[model samples]
Target: MRKIIVIGSMSIDLVVSSSKRPEKGETILGDNFFTTPGGKGANQAVAAARLGEQVYLVGRIGDDDFGKEIYENLKDNNVLVDGVEPVTQMPSGTAHITIADQDNSIIVVPSANNEVTIEYVKKHLEQLDSGDIVLLQQEIPSETVAFAIEYCDRNGMISILNPAPYREVSNQVIESATYITPNETESNAMFKGNMEDALQAYPKKLIVTMGDKGAIYHDGNRKVTVDGYKREVKDTTGAGDTFNGAFAVGLQKEYDIEKAIAFANLAASHSVTGMGAQGGMPTLLDLEGEWHV
Candidate 1:
């Protein structure tokens, strides 16, 4: 199996179920609360592992109970954690999430995840190779992402970026990418008004994921849209991660952009059929079994 190296954060997420969001200066009683292993990098790594990809995770987590649980989850799911950097100066990152019906909101404290520096990323650059897939997200600092993207470009590897959390992105990172997977809100934020106009800013292929409506692809010249697979959507927490991770697996197998995007869409559709982040992602056999080519 080809390697899928991921650069991002590892966090412990606490989820609350509420009927309505808290109004300004107002408090509401929540129905349920639970803690789980999450973080864009870790979630995507788990997604790839489920999709039968060999995943190498590179990120920082504090030496705490939450961090320990996350590490156990990664190992249980078969993600390669040898590349994960453990930090003692800070605690593991954590996110407080509230799911109100189909709408959800979150607050995150970066913690040790914010310590994922360019030096740490450079230390792992040699782990990548031609034909291998390099995945990144915004859980960590943009500088680290930039370093990894540029490194992948020079190393002749596939660079896939999932710009989540909707932060302003750097053009250099976009230029060094092989593909940029951004959701509707993120796409609009990255592009401002027009996807075509935003896509033109980078030479890499662009993939815009629209929940339920499926995904749109732009490879510099042509534009294609992949229809989303229909399924019961309990929660959309990890859909994008599943798409990006499954797409990485497709590329590792040398699947074309269309086939890869279709595969990703299928994977994401399957993901929404369940609840939670990693819980919703489908395994390799599950994907192959459900959406056969």
Candidate 2:
């Protein structure tokens, strides 16, 4: 079995439904509101652990009610949470999300997440190995991400970066990754909306996920595109996270990148059929049935 380590954010999300996104200085009535434990990092960690991977999560949350909720959620999902810390002065990271039918907007305030430093990740580096899969997202500091990826590289562990809420990461960091999974928006943004614009220097493979359109792979030399599964999407909150999680499982199973993305694509399609981020992910059986892989 492959050991998987995920380093990122663990946050509580407050979601509200409205007919339209509110404008500045405008008050809009909402239909309903709900709270869920979510953070791209935490969601992927849970998704991987539930799929039978040996998983570890490194993140930070406020030393408050939300932190307890996050900790319990990870434990209940069988994810190792020893590396998750509680920041006393900082509030737990949280999101205020607004959903209007198909479109959604989010405002994330990184409180405790802002406090998770490279030192925090360095302390947890002892558990890694060449057989392990290390995953890091951008919810925390870029420096921490650099440290984790560098440590994984030196330790011979394969590192995968899911550049969700995409931000600029160093080319050196990108090159260090075994793989970088970016959704369409992130990819386009990272590439400055020029698909023809080549970023040939990255040493690792690149996966660009286009919702409904499917995923494309550039693994150093060849380029392959995997068509996506079709489903009536209820909410797409955690679809990308599901894709990355399932992809990690595929890598652990030694499936090649193309096969892994296909598996992950199917899993992501399953996730959008329901509501919530981690709430809607498919199991291994679900992926098998949906993709017939």
Best by lDDT: 1
* Regions of model 2 farther than 4 Å from truth: 197-204, 219-221, 291-293
lDDT per residue for candidate 1 within 178-282, as digits (tens), equals 899998889888888688766655534888888778888766776667888878777788888889888898887778888888888899888877767777899
TM-score of decoy 1? 0.95
Task: Report the Cα lDDT for candidate 1.
Answer: 0.85
In candidate 2 the C-alpha lDDT for residue 281 amounts to 84
Those runs of model 1 whose alpha carbons end farther than 4 Å from true positions after fitting are 199-204, 219-221
Tens-place lDDT per residue, model 2, 1-293, is 88888898889988888788778899989988899999888989988886757888988989899999999999998999888879899889998888787757788888899887988888887766676998888889988998888788878898999987888988788778888888777877877776434434342377888877788876666566789988987778888888888889888888887888888888888888977788788777665645554
267, model 1: CA deviation in Å?
A: 1.1
* Candidate that scores best on TM-score: 1
Q: Give per-residue lDDT, candidate 1, residue 56.
A: 88
Instruction: In model 2, state the lDDT of residue 19.
Output: 81
